[model samples]
Target: MAAPPEKKTLRIGVLYEHTQMTDLAGVDILGNMSTKSVNLVATLEPRVSALLPLSTPMEFLYISSTLEPSWTTPDMFVKPTHTYANAPRDLDIIMLGGPDPAAAHEDSITFLKKASKQTKWILTTCTGGMWLARAGVLDGKKATTNRMFVAKHAGEWFPKTEWLDQRWVVADGEFEGAQIWTSGGAGCGESYVSNTR
Candidate 1:
């Protein structure tokens, strides 16, 4: 019998804007559900999206239209690389965020398509959806943004996708779209439930 051909290693890229939007909210957000305060840690339940690789390494890539200071300061999950690394080749998964909302929307997509050949999974948070929509990723994928856009264009941009009014995390597309995840906007240096049913 003939032996099977060897499989190729999958590559993933996570590209985020240089700016990190500090979406504002208050600690008592639950009190004034309609209030979007600007000095509080919005309680957001971060949903983890698992990958499908057998043993591929996760690569975290960053991009900024502006000068984003290196975040070497440690907090929890990881320590800073403290150096520069190559793109596509290094990342197996891509996560994105910024100090501002428009940054994510303005710079995440075209860059993504340029590297889509190697990207296995593309994920974002909060207003990150705007970025994906610009990239045409959400052109036809079931996705959700925050209360703001959902009211304006969730159904319009992701025309090919099913836009749900309530869901903590949403995944659309199969295989090709596999691992594409989006979550609600975080407020005031933190994430919020924004999960209104």
Candidate 2:
């Protein structure tokens, strides 16, 4: 038999919340070429098949001036979360997930350091990207976010990172103090691509 193709391993660190939205529609579902789609909640994302752990690791993190503790004990009791829990320090990838934006607010900067400090990629969706800026990983780098929020405020809040307003996905890179990726628009999430190659 012929030899099989080699599989590439990519560790993506995603930070998500409970109320945050997602983009899931496509050319057929949108009925238009510009419909921005997003799932209400996710971690690994259904699109990311073949990856271990179905539910994205969701943490009870807050992005604010004062750091707060996590309340993750409830997820184990809830079935909606698939009884999933957070990952240890030695996972292949780490993606933050949740459904609430306001609730994501906190002052804990250590989480970002611990998550993205030594991972292949620190990926985030929606407001989760906001946390990256606060973490200082995107400092002196470029990034983008969903158009739902005002650009002016987004730029002001994440001044260290460049605010990209393009209408497509933008991937800066994947490394410590090197690459920073951002989606141009949630609409383009359907045809998402990377700049790795």
Candidate number of the best lDDT: 1
Query: Candidates' TM-scores?
Result: 0.50, 0.51
Whole-structure CA lDDT of model 1: 0.43
**lDDT, residue 177, model 2:** 46
Model 1 residue runs over 4 Å out of place are 1-14, 18-59, 65-86, 98-107, 156-161, 172-177, 187-197
lDDT string, candidate 2, 124-176, tens digits: 44444555667676677766666554287668777787777654334443454
- What root-mean-square deviation over C-alphas does model 1 reach? 12.7
The lowest-lDDT stretch of 10 consecutive residues in candidate 2 is 27-36
lDDT (tens digit, per residue) of candidate 1 on 19-71: 23332221123223322221121334222111111122222234433334433
Instruction: Give Cα distance to truth, residue 80, candidate 2, Å.
Output: 9.4
Tell me the lDDT of model 1 at 70.
Answer: 34
